[model samples]
Target: MTTPVLNTVLVRCSHTYQDELTVGDTKLLLDTTFRPEWHRKISAEVVAVPRKLNTRHTAYRGLKLGEIKAGDTIYFHYFGLTKENRLDTEDQDLYAIPYHEIFCKVREGVISALNGWALVEPVEVKSGSAWIGTDSEKISTQEGILRFIGHPKTDQPALNVQAGDRVVFSKNADFINTIEDKDYFIMQQEDLLATQPQKANEIESDYAGPRHYYETSPFYLSPDHD
Candidate 1:
């Protein structure tokens, strides 16, 4: 295998899923298995690294992934899934991705947000069926409960808020990921506007009213297909 150079890191993608295929004239329906969005592979093992840095690649100097070493399992961006980035070989599923595209190391048994990124669990409301941001046009009140906080990096500084803090972040942030069928957003720590520690009484829970005792919240969808 050829070593990547000039801040380009080589990696073999973990695994992604698709249920349908179109070849020639047939539309094939594959397995009916429903894999949650998190199960979709986004982390990959670093196969090779550049020997020398490029003068123009400032991001390669102090990488958030820290040294961008080989054998590191890191989460990266989609890179638009361009054919130019992928090598369609007979056996190798290799991708030559720029070092900047690699986000952070895959924290074992946990989700790790690195380089000033925060993993946020959207505050559930309306009987725990709807999300806080889903209905509110008001950005001030929109909030998320932090699940994991990233470590400080060279250019990416750590957030003042810790895990479990309720935070209202700026509208400039946008990125939502589904883990175990639940939604979480990964936004830059600098985007946070205000923060507060989680309170017991103010703890977000399934909203319950007298009517909820007899019926489900309108946002709910039963596992049974209707």
Candidate 2:
């Protein structure tokens, strides 16, 4: 029962492993133990959290603090957690995660991106000919559809785009996050361009020689703004 200091959260991580490896042939074979992948962002159980600055608690009932709770399942970058912030225990290892470092929360098998991050599926643009022997080609559009968005923050206004909206963005924003088995881009609110209609926009242009890339921008009144 440790009440984390400040807005930090104390969590116990869940371990994932790959199957054992067998080396050598027949009689001289050796079986290697399961290898742990601690390098990736892993899920963890919230042990405790301090709701206030430099606060402590003897016991927390539901362990609920703001949107975080004691027993809630959340994701964090374990390999990225600094060595000074980790603690070891006989039962399970514990980590002190900054309130903003919480990747997302897992609730009833559904994941909601947190800390102003939004989950998106990149739209696949392709070209193909109807000819029987022709092969299809994939183009990098740098565009995606908005999926689940994180909770609203007090300091930021609501984003212009919502779930199911098509948006254009730059190459890669942040590290890719995988949920279940599907990979989604964890994008910040500022990286998103204005939402476009579901139907593709075919803007006319004179430079039509293999336009494989796409770019987006927000409207601004200031000309000097870069």
Candidate 3:
């Protein structure tokens, strides 16, 4: 006899896909994956926030950090567009699946914007360099191109960069042999999940010149006289 697993949340499947699925769908996916009988309990809430513009296709907007407190209960599903090619005996056609499956929480909701974060900076290449794109399109120089790194976005899949992989950027810089490629930019830094240091003390650049010490101070009176 299959022992009935006890759970307080009930999840249902929804045919339609929405940024925020119904609460019912949330419970169903949880039941299948997060075996409540054997795993520790985890929960959170879904709160909406401003969406970032020009993000990846799968990256939806309106998700904020701290949407759910540490112990609040919540459920979710994957929401986005997908493409699939298939050849079959019954029918020959491509199957594009826009699916939403329920998912239960086994840990804290730490992936929210408030809890989750990112840092973006222009790519850096020297004034002159030679490089090639994963597409084999040779970049001769760096001019109208920008390179950066952060949480993997849906855009620019050719980057093939991982959490620690170096991100390189290149554009069509030449039309002849030994294309005249210039270094545009590079986000050679590691994953920026937290605050980024604008200036480091060890290596000082002109960009980090000493301040006048009055950027935020008003005219000061003489020390001897008020």
lDDT of each: 0.58, 0.56, 0.24
TM-score of 2: 0.63
Candidate 2, residue 58: how far the Cα is off, in Å: 29
Residue 176, candidate 2: C-alpha displacement in angstroms: 1.2
168: Cα error in model 1, Å:
1.6
Candidate 1 to truth, TM: 0.62
Q: Candidate 1: which pairs clash?
A: none
Q: Can you write out model 3's per-residue Cα lDDT over 69-183, one digit (the tens) per residue?
A: 2233333322211112121323222121111111222234222211122212222232235422322233333221222233332222223333322223233211111001211
Against the true structure, what is each candidate's TM-score? 0.62, 0.63, 0.18
Model 3: CA > 4 A from native: 1-158, 163-226
Query: Across residues 12-92, which tens digit of lDDT does each residue of candidate 1 receive?
Result: 763443345454556655452543332345556777877765635666544543445677766666441235877576535
